[model samples]
Target: MAKEETVLQGMIDRLIEIGRCYGMEMNVEKTKLMKISRQPTPATIKIDQKQLENVKCFKYFGSLLTDDGRCSCEIKSRMAMAKAAFSKKKNLFTSKLDLNLRKKLVKCYISSIALYGAEIRTLRAVDQKHSESFEMWCWRRMEKISWTDYVRNEEVLFRVSEQRNILHEIRKWKANWIGRVLRRNCLLKEVIEGKIEGRV
Candidate 1:
């Protein structure tokens, strides 16, 4: 059994209004309507607002809406949509660290580690003091990272360096779209939650 799309929209609107009356506003800029039920599915309804973190409050009410009816799959499927909506409402921003930049950074870092070779211990020792070299080189358009990790010589001696090219590549792709939206939403949520207060 399922509810009609129009009816669902109406219910959502009413809930939004109620929330506003309580001094909490719905993010109208990110609101959207969609049909998720069969054309003639019964009177059942499902409402979810867990991902609407940008809104001060996300309230829903309906006899047909139930908690047990929502499955994990449904929640996971809509997570990206919710993130995107939050991004829109909050106008979140992210740095444009393109793929090329990431690739160069990883490649150079890995190469430095490789130079230390099979005698990983010695390589790790040299890395302790000269790690800044990589960042400096990168700062000069050579690709680098400004890391502030302090550890004893013994710890660095056992440090193993491995190639993470594929992982970095995947990150680049995600950052351009889904990753960017999710990160922005998370940052916006933090700002709204009193954890971090300032203009996003």
Candidate 2:
């Protein structure tokens, strides 16, 4: 606690000093400190002698990051946002529209939002379940299938002329990221290569 607090305070003090030099001061009231740790200790982090609030979760890159490295919150948040996107454009997607066009719109708008930052997450089984279910939910809505209709997810995908491979899409993205990282001679590659605890 003491070490992190001192470091944070030092950073804040330096920022304030630099801002004074540039004649542009930061709003201490608006500044917040978010420490990423699974086990966080209570510490009063001050900015400009004013206490900055410590947040449990912070938004980064488009995903919600918590102190714990779990994807449940991110999955739920994405689902809610995706449902909102779908509901907002529900009127525009008419029944008379071509099935292919409806599928295209769902993929382009809704899926893009739901899966925006999913590639970086180390997804658990339940996280993947939510992602797959969300995809089928959108497909069913586009095909106008309801609970009353005894239709399976595969049937919904078939009706919409879509592929039942949302999980593979995420895997493909992860693979692409790994490929890029492997080819780069940078910090990420060095960090990954430096940690070699197991060799067989």
Candidate 3:
């Protein structure tokens, strides 16, 4: 662990050198650093005598990543994004389309948005509840069922002829991702197995 900062600095220096060789300059001022740890301390990485800002959370490839290595925030962000996406196509989803086709559309669009990078997420009971709630929200909105109607989730599922399968889908995705990772001889597999050298 003590060598982590040194190794990171070395990598940064090498990257800078390569950029210079390619006539490309790195914008150190715009660069951010994040360290994932249960008890994280401040990291000071300097470039051109300017310290890079350390962030508690940041977005990468449309997914929220936090210093605590927890995916709760990411899940919440995904839910929000999914809701926004649903709102954009609210007319189509709530149109007079066939129930089966609407369900399939929800699965392909809203669910995909919500489940982006879900395979790498570590979901707790609360996260699972949030996901289920998002799933129900989608169904309720598609059916144009008002919250004041006080319709039960089972009734909603029955009306939609569907089951609560978001959690199941996430689990399946995670299982498949794990299988692929286990079969590969790569850095990710080594990291998952805690077999990386110089890692504490």
Candidate 4:
């Protein structure tokens, strides 16, 4: 931490100096430094001689990044957004449409909403449970199978007739997204290269 703080401060100082040389101004009010570690920073970071606030978490690219790096916050936020999306099209889900049509709607709309920001996520078992709960909730609603019906979960899957469950969909979408990222030879691919290679 000591070394990283010193190096980070030096980088920030250089950035400010370069920006000044180019006659560019940084928005000091919006500037803040986030340290992603359990240990407190030994030194304060400054931008243009102003102290930057340290926060436990920060929102970036529509995802919640925390010091501990747990993804629960982001997952909950995604669930809310996806539920809202489903609610927006409630009429379509509850309509007398074909089973296949409603299934398509769930994939196209709610799945898109829920799976946003999830492509790069390393989902833990708890996270997977939450995701699966939401997916089964949708399936149950689509089949009009109340808890009172006392039907087995297998029955629900049988009723839906969709081969790909939510987890499968997640895996497929994430694979597709990663393929695109890899094809572009992007920075993310560079970061993931060693992990994927080592695992193989």
Candidate 5:
């Protein structure tokens, strides 16, 4: 009488014998075996996982969705870039004592631009305006400051100036009115600082 062969046991015995002959070792811990169901067509799978999980997902790179349920990685990346630029500028603009102070400064930046020399103001604006983006305005202001008589760092001056120019061109290409406001405000800030005069 012959012994009946166990399906999984027989497969493991065959694999081990083959591996021994080839002087190789198989990592059973890293291996998985599956049995297919009796179906003629392949099964479909739907993943309901959230892409922007902060704990397990990558930082500065995650899925962002709109209020309308549009999952756009490109839009998220652009927003992230804008926020990063604002963050870098905010670091240079304020003291580094408290983490919460940066948020306050950003809120101030938004409010300052929104007021725009207004009187009797109540609540401050926290959202972006059609006239300018906070990121662009920050770079423009930095450049304006760098060119002042008190600041003698030519490298910083040139870098901020160059960046402002590049951002200006990008805004122009996008036909954004913010570009015009950026230029006007930049010139105005420079004038106020007594760095340059006469028609910007």
Candidate 6:
């Protein structure tokens, strides 16, 4: 492990040198280090005698990534963002438009927000339950139904003429992504198939 850290530090040094040749300097204060592992240990990586900040979680390409490699936090973040987006367009969803059109809008707009990066998510039972609940919540809110209304989830689906398809949609995306990766000859395929050496 110490040897690997030394190699990483050497590589960072080379990168810094190359960036300097291009007149680009790395912002040590803005840079963060996150060690992704089942059991992450503290990693100290320094640049120019300054240490980078370590984070338990950070957003990368708009998706939350954590040290534990779990997607629950990302899922919750997506759900909250989706709910806020729904609230912003509440009028359109609850408008007197055709029910089918409203449902389409929800699927096109809200689901896209909630399911962003879901294809790569590893969901547990609790996560799946949360996703289903979020789906039902969207429908209920669109129908203007309150929790006190005691409306069953099925009733909400019935009113919307939709079924619980969030999980199915996620599975479909995973399948498509896997198929595409498998068809290509790339490092990602090797990583996915565990062909890379020294992988944790």
Number of the predicted model whose TM-score against the real structure is largest:
6
lDDT of each: 0.39, 0.78, 0.91, 0.79, 0.42, 0.90
Candidate 6, residues 103-195, lDDT tens digits: the string is: 999999999999999998999999999999999999999999999999888888888888999999999999999987776657666777888
C-alpha RMSD in Å of predicted model 3 compared with the true structure: 5.8
| lDDT by residue for model 1 (40-129), tens | 223323334332212222223311212333222222223333334333433111224564554454344443332221121212334332
TM-score of 4: 0.78
Q: Which residue runs does candidate 1 get wrong by more than 4 Å?
A: 1-9, 12-34, 37-175
TM-score of each: 0.20, 0.80, 0.85, 0.78, 0.20, 0.87
The per-residue C-alpha lDDT of model 4 at residue 141 equals 78
Greater TM-score among 1 and 6 belongs to 6
- Candidate 3 Cα misplacement greater than 4 A, ranges: 1-3, 186-200
- Candidate 1: the clashing residue pairs are 2-42, 138-143, 138-144
Candidate 4: which stretches are off by over 4 Å?
Answer: 1-3, 38-43, 145-151, 177-200
Model 3: lDDT equals: 0.91
The number of clashing residue pairs in model 1 is 3
Per-residue accuracy of model 3 over 1-200 as CA lDDT, tens digit each: 23498788888888899999999888977899998889989898878788889999999988899999899999999999999999999999999999889889999999999999999999999999999999999999999999999999999999999899999999999999998887665766677788876432
lDDT (10s digit) by residue, model 2, range 12-127: 78888988998988887776666655676556877656788777777877779876657789889988998999989986664677777877888789888888877788889988
Ten residues in sequence with the least summed lDDT for candidate 5? 49-58
Candidate 5 per-residue lDDT, tens place, 76-195, comes to 344455556555665455544453454456546543333332221111233223223434444344444533445434454354443323234333444545576788999999999999
Candidate 5 deviant stretches above 4 angstroms: 1-63, 67-86, 89-131, 144-200
Estimate the TM-score for candidate 5.
0.20
Q: Which ten residues in a row have the lowest lDDT in candidate 1?
A: 114-123
